[model samples]
Target: MSTSYDCSQPEPRREGLAAASGAVRAGQLVVFPTDTVYGIGCDAFSSEAVRALLAAKGRGASMPASVLVGSWHTIDGLVSSVPQAARDLIEAFWPGGLSLVLPHAPSLSWELGDTRGTVMLRMPLHPVALELLREVGPMAQSSANRSGSPPATSMEQARTQLGEAVPVYLDGGPSGDPVPSTIVDLTAVEPRILREGAVTAAQITEALGHDVPVAG
Candidate 1:
């Protein structure tokens, strides 16, 4: 069975972080709170860990995992291009509820499922997640639930669904947003919304000062 920690306590917060980061570096899965919902994540650089993450969710490679970075510097280190449109979006609503798909760098040797030549990235706002991300570097994470099931907004729900498959569960209580992030693909010729959630279409349009197209 996995250990669960309440992040509100200072001592447990430190202990939880140590356990979670260790699991990540060891290529193991851990559950933590995010801005949207609870997420299951591991070191994105570890293909084996990513496979385990997908398997734990009962998902296949066709569904790609999103990358969570601690900062913009981490994003720059992993990816090649951040178009003006992406920069605008990042500046307006980053470290919050937006997931941007940018061009992946050739030098990078890690994979995030069937991500193609692009990677979906975000800097989560939750302190527990941000702290873990800062410690673990880039992590490939997805909603903490079985595939085709509702995401776990609470740590209790996540534990029930995921069980001991994940070694560490950082209990940050309920996440900020019950909904997922708005996914925008900047690698496309025009910015496209892969999925609409926390960030509205109108807000994205206004943020970019132009018309943003929608694909889904």
Candidate 2:
């Protein structure tokens, strides 16, 4: 059966992270709150745990999951390079609702499912997420919900949809906006907006102080 912990409540925050860390260490799936939305995560190094997470969400193994880190430094060697523009964007809007797809490092295992040699990466702006990432290290995560369904915005929704399949749901209250992150492929020549989400083209432009040509 799955466990729930209230991260907003001081007592449960510490215990929740400990439990979530234990779940990750045991190669079990965990549902946790991110800055953009709730995410289901597993130890990035464990293929078995990755498979379980995919099965829980009814997601195809072909779809690669994004890896969330405590900060850019934590994800440094995991990705090949962060484009200058992408670096500026991260400097401005990361730890918020932006996800960047950059070339993957050859040294890392491909279990995160980045068959295209790129990894979706983000540094969530939530204390719970930061603390959890710090404790458990980088985590392979995607929105916590059934594949093709609206992403869960609350721990209760994740619990109802995922049930006992997920090992733990770190309850940090309702996620804001109920929208996913803005995904951009920084590796592309013109940079492509893979998904129109919380961050808009105009907002990204504003953040960068220039009109970024976004591929369709």
On lDDT, the leading prediction is 1
lDDT of 2 by residue, 45-158 (tens): 798888888888897769878888887687678877766878787888878888888888888875876358888888999999988898889898988999988889999988
lDDT of each: 0.90, 0.85
For model 1, residues 1-216, the per-residue Cα lDDT tens digits are: 799999999999999999999999999999999989999999999999999999999989899898998987777777787688988888888898899998899898886888888899999888999999988899999999999888999999999999989989999988865888999988867989988988999999999998888894
CA RMSD of each candidate after superposition: 1.1, 1.5
What range of 10 consecutive residues in model 2 has the weakest lDDT sum? 207-216
Candidate 1 C-alpha error for residue 200, in Å: 1.0
TM-score of 2: 0.94
Q: Candidate 2: give the clashing pairs.
A: none
**Candidate 1 structure, TM-score to reference:** 0.97
Using TM-score, give the best candidate's number: 1
